[model samples]
Target: MADLTGKRIVVGMTGGVAAYKTAELVRRMMDEGATVDVVMTEAATKFITPVTMQALSGRPVFVDPWDPRVPNNMAHIDLSRGADAILVVPASTNFMARVAHGFADDLLATLCVARACPLLMVPAMNREMWGNPATQRNAAQLRADGIVLLGPVDGDQACGEVGSGRMMEPHDVLQELIAFFQPKPLQGVRVLITAGPTAEPIDPVRVLTNVSSGKMGYAIARAAREAGADVTLVSGPTALATPRGVLRIDAHSARDMMSAVMGETPRADVFIAVAAVADWRVAEASAQKIKKTAGEPPTLSFVQNPDILATVAALPGGPYCVGFAAETEHLDQHATEKRQRKGIPLLVGNLAQDALGADDTTLILYDDQGRHPLPRQSKLAAARELIAQVARRLPAGRVPTLAARPAPGSPSAVPSAPPSPLSLP
Candidate 1:
């Protein structure tokens, strides 16, 4: 199903070149199953015709407060009545100032004042204009009034000067909209996640790595961020963009991943180890590329890599740890045993052949209470469900502070046998 299914959105367009982008936003919202009602200001009509927005929304665009099409002649009141949210795209400085002080002179501004739903504004203007003290104060006032400002992210502006005040792209706006509706169960929580396949060097140009694409881990990071968690991702090599609002650290080898995880674990409320780390690494990797042999292949020695999950789980009063097991056979037996061996509160299991590098797969959560299978679905969906489960298991009150826990590499932080399993909800 689409993310915004059955959502009703009222899109308000103010005067700006970014109105072209809003056309795409309206179409994309509908594609995601949201019915959009476009409301344009007189200045907005000057930039982009109401006909264009009307064609995209498949409804008459409202410009005048007294739009005769509305049976009650109160377009502002009727348009925003049942809206899930009212988004003012490319909200001009004039419009923002007007709304900031409760001046409902225009149709869109009037609707905003009358609407009961949440209000989101996307600012788009020249860098100098956005940097102006007056504009800043207005922005602050709007925020203080419970208005959500999506972004006027720093980038090239239409006036050609590069700085702040660029409107977020249409696709990004759509993502923010989707996230705004998600439950913030992980709010104020710090999450540390490891993803992708760690590469262990055998030579300068040769390394051993698994087939993990990091899709599932990245999805979980996105889902967790959407749920309002402060997320940090320790990622192995992958060709994927960092999820918006996530701090990503790159880890190439198993040891690299272990070090990164250790450094971040002290601050985390929850730790999810999902990377397909190589179990072993070359004991004495060649300084240069290994030369190809004509008669026989070169023999290489191997040493076991440090177990990241077990190490974190062994930390006294550490973050709640969750592990992932991808098995080719005997999933239940292997997954349950691994969870116990690692001493983590939760373990997610799936068939390696079915899940690695795939867009969708079935996930089974193993905890103190036997197996709980989740329906096969997209990685993002599974990630959201997993995050929900993790949220439920978290203990009440704030996570332990840094002062309350030993530093990761200190002598007192040495690994011990896993303590009794964490109590699950």
Candidate 2:
């Protein structure tokens, strides 16, 4: 069955350039067999004409509750009565605050106040407004009230200022709407993921670390959670916020990360190794910050840190382990070799330069089945594909994969879809 077929969605548009996108969103949702009711705020009407929306929806766009032409002037009440969910695209700071306060001055807020269905608000505005404490507080309040805030994507904005606060694209919002109703296929599973670059302390302030920003691992954790898994994310230092429902364990150095993962890995049903662990640490020295000597330079002995992926994969009663191979050159060869050497049933490989810190990546998933190239997509979308692939690889009735014999990353390794993409976005 189509997940969103015949599903009712109420889309709220506010005063922003993004409001124009809502008309397209309405059409797309309809294409997916969704019945969408457009509710436009006064400010929203300034951006997208009610006539245009009405033509696209083939239904009157709800603008005011007290329009005398409408029966009993109850347009707001009737519009939201049977929605499967509500999506507030182009949700402005003003609209957010009103929703946060249960203000019903506008038709959109009135509908939200009266609706019992799931509430999803996609906030779109200037980055500064988005970052303002009051706006953030309102968003927090709305979330706490069971409002699902999708996105105000980051990048260049209509106002010429940039940071965040752009509404999610129509297709993305539509996909989210579809996924919302699908059966949680990976439900009841427990996932443990390690992400970001593990630091190896040298001098007091100096440390060894890579360019990893912990995007992939954390995205996996999020995807697993959305699929109904209990996820524990063991992450190294990074600027990303922890996803909802994920238990985040902070780690600094490779040793710290190893200890944390070792402690949690056993209980997980699936373990994905995505962290770029520092290869070596200072053997000894530096009780305080090392001073730059006026002479030549100082030398420090280095010791290799434990290979976290290899260690975790080898555990007798461990979770089904997955590893990542990030290479600068010969990406496929190295990833395949790492996959075999690490003894993981699955390995996610990608180019470090293109995949390192960017929001988009193309992955080559290596396994007994061979390598499958997953098209470049946002980290969030890639995460979903990876979760689904993991589910398929695992044995039926369990989240563990069936035994597969392979030549170990051999040139003839079975190909599937590309490995999951990770991004700091």
Candidate 3:
């Protein structure tokens, strides 16, 4: 998420040996297309030269408040004008206390206090200095004043004695900055997502599965997390790493997937069925591997797997259902029919050959308003678009509970508190 394109940032450096790392931070921000302005305190010059930072940032670094650089002689006020954000990298304990106490002793403090932009503080100091009670109170006060703090990560330090109080790597700091700029489109929404291809075992070694790579699903999960949703990913077998901040549940077969989905769906605000589940599983899977006979191949019996999407959509007051259709031909017809049949509000369709195990996709979204084609793009971009679409279509408030179904063979029986078992665990 370190995509800082077109952003204007002021990177502030304070007195700390960790100021050496601030050069990399400024370089990285510039690499991400951000126009960076470096501001250094007097003590900061001892650790890293302003000339080095000026070369990296390709701009004059600010050192003195009255250095005659600004036409108005208000360098502190003019510097942050039109700026999107201000970052205090390698924020020393002294600077933290100064910012916390609103002391404008120098340009960094003056600009930070006078700026209208969002402020982020990246603390870097000795473990003892960071752990001091005064520093802790100052940090707390800054947080109370709505200042965002990145990290003084735990690791080996310049002083050679380390537990905590090391600056976060430049890449991580950029990621935090990116996240800060992202819009929380899915805030307070609980999303349950299914990903990958479910296996239907025929024997210990033989099974039926598909070519799904789970890339799209995982992308969607990551997008949802970025959008500030509480996400739970119910996944079949895949080698992909879990997205940050997403709770993942592993399921190997269609049955296991159903169980996991059922367990989590009730509390979800949205449910996206992206897993390619086996249509039929072996009725009685062999305990041992089945050997081929010389005369003929062994016959196998099959049974239908639970219809997870349809079952969830049919439930009383169920979450908003979104189904995926991977069709070889007649994509529109199949996608529309599937959406209607499953009683889902939205359906995403793409060619099986184009999407299966592929990073880029051309998606056709089917919904109440009709079909909309999204041009081919990377799965991550597509996922972001999809999340935006869902956020727009979400109801004003929670959907009202549906009328309860009558009990079997008893028309007058009262409704049960929970619906009947859709799929056995």
Candidate 4:
């Protein structure tokens, strides 16, 4: 009934006090588009039993390898063939040993050893039991055998003990399972993004910068990485730490921002202007702090910075460019004008009051298809939606479109080669 419509999953339960958690896992996997088949280890039935699993998964449970009811009909082969993947939750130390040693003494173990599709295992046990060197070695072997190992997070345990080795919560495991099934949609695609707030210098010790916290942009970078895009994050000064697995080029002034973005635009498949770049900068920054004389406020001259988005879009056969607009009024009109004038394929506009320094945002995507409103959600979710739209709209490649060399005497400077593509996916 949830989003999963066509996926087929095989859920195996093993002996552990946390075995009950597997029922919720099966239910969630089914709700998210999976048809689940449940199998229970002998010891697991002693904890939560199989009738409950049968009711939750809507499939009869399998416990013994020699059980004639399902086997006479070639059910084992059928069950193995029907699933897209196999998942073992509450993978106890004993079960891990059985799997590692290739022992198929039970139905669940037999199916695991027999499945043709991919296998994923989520370990859950007491901290001391999980930390056993034998269990660690078995897990390493599983990884080497190409099994997907979901997290066994560190936290308090059910046995009145506290340390490493807790099963990841149901929701988090669901996310990992979904991500595991997702196609590398952005494979080999290069994306360039600008983030954070550029500083407008007033003096050595004072600078004017907006309240842009860079959370939204950083979230987008992570989502893009998850989507399998090689992402380059051109960032301005922000207090936030750089997200691991992203290429970050720091910029302080509008000039530095342009240089970072320009250097990475040519080879990019997509360019996102998420940075709140200062429109104007002090005409001349004081090399040192200007001391106050306790008199009238000093005047500072300002000059318009180079329009980076427009400059990149004007490149001949440039990358597919997208711009962001943080507007409070006349949002549609302004976004439409910016999209047309900047010649960008897409413009993502959100209310500044709702978006600035926030972790959630609602966005209106202005593109060739007109406006599509994305309801307020986590910045990561919004980023995924935006990227999916971009992917759907991406035209099949015809040629490698490099940025145009600047014409002689042009005001905007040409950027160097684009950053080499890298992705967490």
RMSD of each: 8.0, 11.6, 10.1, 9.7
Once fitted onto the true fold, the runs of candidate 1 whose alpha carbons sit more than 4 angstroms away are: 398-425
What lDDT tens digits, residue by residue, belong to model 1 across residues 1-425? 99999999999999999999999999999999999999999999888999999999998889888888989999889888889899999899999999999998989999999997888899999988899999999988876666778778899878888999999999989988888777767756789999999999889898999899999999999999887778999999999899877899999999999999999998998999999999999999999988888979999999999999999999998998999999999999999999999998899999999999899989999999999999999999999999999988877654743234443224343223211000000
TM-score for candidate 1, residues paired by index: 0.93
Leading candidate by lDDT: 1
Q: Rate the local accuracy (lDDT) of all candidates.
A: 0.88, 0.78, 0.85, 0.79
Top model number, TM-score: 1
Local error of candidate 4 at 73, Å?
A: 15
Residue 237 in candidate 1 has what lDDT? 97
Model 2 weakest 10-residue run by lDDT: 416-425
Candidate 4 Cα outliers beyond 4 Å, as residue runs: 1-111, 121-178, 239-245, 398-425
Estimate, for each residue in 173-241, the C-alpha lDDT of model 2 and write its tens digit: 776666555435565578899999887777778887888888888778778876656789989999998
Across residues 1-425, which tens digit of lDDT does each residue of candidate 3 receive? Answer: 33688899999999988888889888988887899999999999999999999999999999999978788889899889899889999899999999999999999999999987778889998999989999989987876566767777899888998867888888778766765666656655789999999999999999999999999999998888777677899999999998756899999999999999999997898999999988999999999999888888888999999999999999998899999999999999999999999999999999999899989999989998999999899898899899989888877666322123233224232122211111000
lDDT per residue for candidate 4 within 1-425, as digits (tens), equals: 24457888888889888887887888888778788888788889999978999999888888877667764755557678967788889888888889888987777787878888878788998988888998888877776565667768888888889887899878777766765554446655788889999998888899978889888888777667656567899999888876544788899988899998888887787888999999998898899998889898889899999999999989888888889999989999999998999988889999999999888899999987789999999887788788888776776662233223232223222112112112111
Backbone N/Cα/C clashes per model:
0, 16, 0, 3
lDDT of 4 at 375: 90
Candidate 4 accuracy as lDDT: 0.79
lDDT: which is higher, 2 or 3?
3
Q: What are the TM-scores, per candidate, against the unseen true structure?
A: 0.93, 0.61, 0.80, 0.63
The TM-score-based order of candidates, best leading, equals: 1, 3, 4, 2
Displacement of the residue 169 alpha carbon in candidate 1, Å: 0.9
